[model samples]
Target: MGVAWPFADRNEGFREGLELALDEINRQGVLGSRIRLIEKDDKSSVTDGLTIAQAFANNSELTAVIGHRSSAVAVPASKVYDHAGLLLLAPSSTAPGLTAAGVDRVFRLIPDDTQIGSTMAAYAHAKRFNNVAIFYANDEYGRGLANAFEDEAKAVGMQTVDRLTDYKDLNDLRRIVAKWKLLGCDAVFVAEVMPDGAKFVSDLRKAGMKVPVIGGDGLDAAALADTAGGAAEDTVVASIFNPFAANEAVRHFVRSYEDKYNEAPRKWAAQGYDSLKLLAYALEQAGSREPSKLAEALKRTKSWQGASGPHSFDGSGDVRDMPIILKQVKDGAFQYLTEGARANE
Candidate 1:
């Protein structure tokens, strides 16, 4: 088995999760043969991810791939895995195009950006933020999320004041904030990964912009507080998993993870564990290493319980009827906004 990420230093939670998951799998003897994981760092580059994925696909020893965290990397890397007839399970990539691309071998543990977008729009409506502005990363993940949010906002009769897209540049973010202010946006929705999202928030604060900022799962990384500093307070985000959850299985996983890593596991870690659990279940049901059989078994997976949540793939190979959670940054930490809290606006 092999696990790939966009970068080595950037995704500590994801890396820790991959290591912990492999250890658990080895201890449980889930595979008849001892499973070994090969880690590859793509440096968050699409070309590098595709290159490594192609190489892995050609390697007969690697049964499947666990990642390529960003949708920017997952989109192209998935094509390589598809060509080689290997399954690629993305732990964090939420770009809707991955599942909708009509690729048979690609699957994701998290809901697509469209789902998150709809949830964000619903939250905006609930909060009565009628005039919304969108800021995106200018990449596959950002652009897709912005587009989804825009569509949903329009559906709910909310007016979109501005749509700003920028590459990984802080100066561009300053320009966008100025534009949003001119457009009279009441709330800002940022759709970008941690790096850019954190920087945008920090810069917005430096510019003395106080409009509420809402983000998708990409902003759930631990670095958000450090990067955004005191400015991160009151920021809202949508997530698929809650590490502070009290579920029995989640508590066990959290305790085990803390004992091993000396820190609370983030959503990425939970996602990695969930992805491996799904893979193991498919392999167990197939009882063979053949790609065709394993893919079929994976599609047939229904109501499988995972550390992240209960997962069931729809006919389109996407997780269906997934729930989304809203959290707010308070005292420099993320707190789950209860149903009533969110409903009460």
Candidate 2:
């Protein structure tokens, strides 16, 4: 396994989870040979990630590469693996066109931004928020999700007052909030990562706009709550994993992860664990190190149990139509909104 280490602090949990899975798989001798992990720091930069990926592609000992944290990095870096016939398993990157780039070698563990976009739109419409305004980052991750949300929101009889993607200053966000207020938008959806997402929400609150601010996974960072402070209250977020899930798989992962790291595992850590486990399953079933054979085995995966839940990939290498749940930051911590949860809830 080859893993990308951008910010060690941000990815240490993922590394820990991958190491745990690596240990288990090695102990079980699922691969017929002990699996080893080689890591590099992309520094979360696109250029650096690409360089790291190129290095990994040349390493004949590695059968697969595990990550690139951001879509910006993953989209381009995945192409290297595609041409090299190496499997690239993305645990966090969610850009829409990743697997669709004619790259059969790329697979991601998390739901795509497109899924998140549709989920957000449907949730807003279900809540009777007919008028919406979106403030999304202008990058691939944000833009892809925003476009999907726009399509779904329009399809569901929701009215889009505005979709603001250009804003460099706090006053720009203030003005956007004021415009949304004037337009009487019932909800505001944000598709950006913090602290930018948090800054927007905090500024919106400071501007005295009380409309519900719903965010995508880009805003799932803890900084969003800390930066937005009281403004984060009632702010809903769309997520694939429910940390509070009572299932045995989830509980066991939570317990073992905490026991190993002396702290709770982040979403990426659980996803990293699941991705490695899934890879191990494919390797065991395929009984080969060849990429094509491994991929064929992986495509047949159905309802495979993971820390997050049961997962199966669609033809496009996505977990299409997977359950996306809504959670809110109540008081300070993220609280599962049981009041109007989705069917999966």
Candidate 3:
């Protein structure tokens, strides 16, 4: 097995979870012989991701890989993994096109952008945020999710007041805020990843534009509150995993993860653990190490519960009907919002 993703501190929990799962899988003798993990830091760069993909593909010892966190890196790398006949499970990449490419060996553990975006849009509409503004990154993840949200918002009888992309400077963000204010947008949705995403929220609050802010999983990080300060408060984020979930599988994983890492697991961590365990299950079901057989086994999976949630891949290699959790930042932590709780509450 090969693990390739950005090794930034922001994703350290993911590494911890992956290592913990690897330890458990090997200890349990899931594959008869011990399975080894070769890890590569893609640095969240497209060039580095492609390099890791090619290197992993060239290795005859590696039959499977949990690869790339962002779709910008994952989508292109999937082609390389597929051509090499290696099974690739993307733990967090959410661009809809990741599974649209007809790569049989590529599977996504997280729900796609369409599900994530529409979930957020529906939540916004339910909250009476009838007029909203969208600000998204220029990358694939941002563009794909932004489009999905826009479509869903329109369908749900909500109007998108304004849309902005790839703001070149703080001035651009300020301009966007002013325009949104003038347009009477009740909410704002940001679709960029960390640092930039956090920065945007921070800037918006600093500029005194405090309409309700919402985002997809790209903004679902513990660091968001710290980075954005008070600006992150009341911000609703859509995620695949909720640490406070009542599921028995989640409770067990959380206890074990805290025992090992001395901290609560985040969305990425849970998904990483699930990816490895799912692969191990597929290996056992296939009764062979052949990549083709593992791929078939994975597609045949149904109601396989993981630390995050139940996972069953559809024909497109995307997880089917996976639950999306809505969380709000409060007192510098993410708390799962019950259906009865309002976005601000």
Candidate 4:
């Protein structure tokens, strides 16, 4: 397992939830044999993930790997798994291009950022943010979403005033904010993860760029509201799970997670729980450890009653359907607003 462990609670939920799922799966006698899970820290870096993937691929006993929360890590590391004929499943990692045509070894349970970008663009247009600037992380996930939103922005009759990459440093972010401020953009779209996205917005506020800064799933965490403090107010993003869903299953998962962790579960925890459970079902169905057989078995999944939502994998290994819940930071917490969130309407 690979996650950004150093980063506060965002990815910590993933690690804890996955461990709990592994325990349950073992107790139920799934996987035909007692399994041992090894943990590795990718640090959410592409280079580190590549090294970790190479190590896992070289191990013959390793049937599959549950990893790589950041799409930046998944995109490059997946090639290693594909070449090694290992199944790489992720709980997060929503970049669309990772599962594009001809990529068979990688699969994700979350909706890709392509839909997120389009929905965000639509929200921007609906809110009349005609001229928006985009600042994205310099990685596969960020680049993929930046392009997706740029395309959708044009289709929705919105103009992308400027697009820049985060240099991942305070000085670079300060410079980027200055550039966007000078361009007179009505709003900014951030395509980075929790820490980076929140830091970007914090700097924007410090520099006095007060336009409604919207983000993707990266910013859709309670930690961001806490991390960005007052700067997170009015900030919006899309989410994968809905805590307010009245379904008993959803409620049960939430209750179990809260009981286990003493904190309300985030989408990361739900997806992490389902990813391993789904893999157990596929293993039982396949009755073999061969990567090819496991991949095929995973593909045949029409639906899995995920705690996040009902998920069906597409031919390209993306989810067939999942609602994107738009949320905003209010009083230092993430508050669910509506389904298919529009801009301030």
Candidate maximizing TM-score: 3
Candidate 2 stretches greater than 4 Å from native: 338-345
Tens-digit lDDT string for candidate 4 (163-256): 8774656666667777777777899999988787887788878767789989888888677877888998989898888866766767788787
Candidate 3 stretches with Cα past 4 Å from truth are 168-172, 339-345
Residue 343, candidate 4: Cα error in Å is 20
As a whole number from 0 to 100, the lDDT of residue 91 in candidate 3 is 91
lDDT of each: 0.80, 0.82, 0.88, 0.78
Using alpha carbons, what is the TM-score of model 3? 0.95
Q: TM-score each candidate.
A: 0.91, 0.94, 0.95, 0.87
Pairs of colliding residues, candidate 3: none
Residue runs of model 1 more than 4 Å from their true location after superposition = 167-183, 338-345
- After superposing all C-alphas onto the true structure, candidate 3 shows an RMSD in angstroms of 2.3
Ranking the candidates on lDDT from highest down gives 3, 2, 1, 4
The global Cα lDDT (0 to 1) of model 1 is 0.80
Better of 2 and 4 by lDDT: 2
Which residue pairs collide in model 4, if any?
A: none
Global lDDT for candidate 2?
0.82
